[model samples]
Target: MRLFSLRTLLVCTALASCLGMVGAQAATKAQPAPKPSGQKVAMLGGKFAFTLPKDYVKGPMEEIDAKARAAGVTGSLYMNKPAKRVVIITETPLPNDQKVGANDKPTLDGIIADTLQQQQSSYKDFKKLGEKKIVRKGLGMRQLDISGSVDGGRVLSTTITAAYGKRTAMVNVISLAKDAKAHAEVVKGVTGGK
Candidate 1:
């Protein structure tokens, strides 16, 4: 067994604290992944791909699409179900305008926060697993874990938000009528950042 010196102990504790702070900073700070702003590429298991909203940012070229695929979700739909419908939304960070200040928040982050707030109206069961810092497609990102139910069914939701310069995205994954744990697992797998 190796001896434990006071200096060594202090160093280890300091390192652990620094690591924790880094994680916390990463969780709240902006990420580095560029949103898919240009050509609409096939995403997630070849289910579908169309021109994203010009204002919308894009995810990393790789797993962002892959995560969408695993979620078994397709393009955004115009209609909403009356009794019960599972809603999934994904957002990517857009390029920033140089005129804007760095302190400006990403649009996608706003969207996700809005969606979560709106969910308060319809969802009976609401719980947040909190936020985590993640890396997707070699870019820094944030993964938010949310759980709840709408129309008497379970919903497992995950949002991957990326901030590239002035833009940010919140990729949402919502599931229905299934075990919350299982649903979250699927969503994480689909988003490709978990």
Candidate 2:
């Protein structure tokens, strides 16, 4: 059964934006880290703040396209276009009546399960890698390790989701699977591992 609305997991949370898949650009070189954006985005009503990495370019939330915005995704997006990598940090408001909370294990646990199911249903050749419950940035979050084929190519994805007081924040990193080391480093950096 679907624990959350289809909107919550709509089309892989903007991952379907034709990120120019992995195999096509398997030999792409790493672009030099770009200048940092000198701003911080506050989340969880100012309980947390995020700074975009110097290695990727930041695009306005509107760039995420209308479908994602309609699904209630409001946050930042970063991309290293030539490198075939994308990072989406989104803050989505949740309904007051749902089974959700920052500290609610059951809610998060169910989400991870349903999230995997949603991806399996959405992507072609979706594969489960590994996943676990983790604490990041002082919030209990669920992380998924998975891969699948999308519009442009196959990509590896590390998705971390956490809820706190009326809102849920997700850090989704999608990159060419061949750039495993680079992708893992970015995920670690953004999540602030415990």
RMSD after CA superposition, every candidate: 20.2, 4.1
In order, candidate lDDTs are 0.39, 0.67
Best by TM-score: 2
Q: Residue by residue across 1-194, what tens digits does model 1's lDDT show?
A: 01112112222232233234343443332222223343343332232233322333332222224554453322332111221112233332233332222223454355446545554544467787677655555445556676665444355555554444433333444433343443454344445533
The alpha-carbon lDDT assigned to residue 41 of candidate 2 equals 53
lDDT of 1 at 88: 34
For candidate 1, the 10 contiguous residues with the lowest summed lDDT are 1-10
Q: What lDDT tens digits, residue by residue, belong to model 2 across residues 1-194?
A: 32244423533655655353443445657654433353455677765555655657776656446775776657677777676677777776665545454567876776678777777877788899999777755678888989887774678988887777777777778876667877777766666652
Task: Give candidate 2 misplaced runs (Cα > 4 Å).
Answer: 1-18, 21-27, 30-41, 61-73, 97-101
